[model samples]
Target: MNEVLIITGACGVGKTATARVWAKAKQGVAIETDYFTEWIYDDSLERFTREEEKLVANLSLVTAKEYLAQKMPVAIEGVWSPYGLSLLHSGLKKKAKNAKLKFVWLYCEISENHRRDELRVSENQMKQRVDIVSQQLQSYHWENYVHHIDTTYLTLPETLAAIESK
Candidate 1:
């Protein structure tokens, strides 16, 4: 059966990279919600407002539903909380009820996140905003449903193995 994998985490936790790699390996489609949000606000908007996040989330869900309709597996990568993912989960159930849905959360130590953030080259203002948001969203709690991966000390191969083991 086709599946929908929602990959979420704080900023700099490698959600996009991991999702892309996984999708390619599995011959699935990867949707980066940040790309959708960027297309919506490609101007001087330095940060995503809650309203913008909701809009992008909706668009991402729509895209995922479309892919699943085509009998294709999909991976959605984003910095999403449980609340945000709950929205996607409900939408997917309503739109593609038969698709298996999985929620994966990638986590790493604050120091590692900060290091990755510093290594990223982006506008200084954007970097600052991402830093603030990442710090605020460093921890997440969901009861028994989330596939949590602590990527603090894992190499790329190790991380992939951990995710695939799930």
Candidate 2:
């Protein structure tokens, strides 16, 4: 059996940093969902097409299975919603025996101004995405299976230590 850690959060919430530290500490592979799609599309900068999104989701499932088969600790970092979590659980249920799945939600209660600054988004993009994200708060509630980490004011090293302690 393999241990899999799924680090999910909104964009610019430090998923990449957490993934980097977690992978280094556990000596596991870090798989970013964006990169999975980027390889398929051969363009990381362009907006993801509908087909690209589907392909990435499917590939994420495959990657999970592969990691489990190798008995390697895997870290999947992405903006995976509750629906995505359901899909992952379903995909891995048959392949893994007593699969150890851990969900880490990177909760950063950053103000709109700070978020805009940190994300480095243009005013137009900020208004579009931030407005929707703020209204919906898509990343706040997990499906009763996620461990919460309030990253409002933690440094990278401190955050890494917190995860290591867990």
Candidate 3:
């Protein structure tokens, strides 16, 4: 089976940090999903249609397939909703015929106050992202999956170790 790792959580929850360590320790490539949109959209003014978002999402899956073809473990880290993961899970299932694909969700419980303080992105950026995410969450069902790691109090290393255990 092909091995696929997904490291996900809310903003400022250290998902990226844990993913980096897990990828390096496991000798897998770490792909940041956020970069896909950032790279494709040079200007925020140019709004992405729903079709465009799906297209970019497909591109990410295609890239993941390419990595899986190399038979190397791969880590995908970012703020992914259930819909996003559904797309990714389907893509991997289709592409990885003889490989194992694993999905691990890093469920972070970041307090509103802490999120405001510990965020690495600027205040404006955080607000913008959270706003969009808030809107998206209204229609998302977040309880379908059972595999998750609660990262409310764990440090980065602890979180990485927890995910690595299973």
Tell how far residue 104 is off in model 2, in angstroms: 1.8
| lDDT of model 2 at position 120 | 65
Candidate 1: residue 96 lDDT (0-100): 81
- Candidate 1 lDDT over 1-166, as tens digits, reads 8877888877778887888887888788999887776565445534466777778779998898788878888999987766777778788889888888888888887778777778777652345545555655654566466788998898767877887778
* lDDT of residue 72 for candidate 1: 85
| Model 3 per-residue lDDT tens digits across residues 52-130 | 5566568777877888778767778766666667777777777776656656665543354257435565532554454
Q: Output the number of the lDDT-best candidate.
A: 1
Question: lDDT: which is higher, 2 or 3?
Answer: 2
Off by over 4 Å in 2: 37-55, 112-131, 139-141, 164-166
Ranking by TM-score: 1, 3, 2
Go through the candidates in order and give each one's C-alpha lDDT. 0.77, 0.65, 0.64
Model 3 residue 60 CA deviation (Å) reads 1.7
The superposed Cα distance between candidate 1 and the true structure at residue 104, in angstroms, equals 1.3
lDDT of 2 by residue, 61-160 (tens): 7887787677677788876666666666666666665777777777666473246345564632333443343334443457776777777788878776
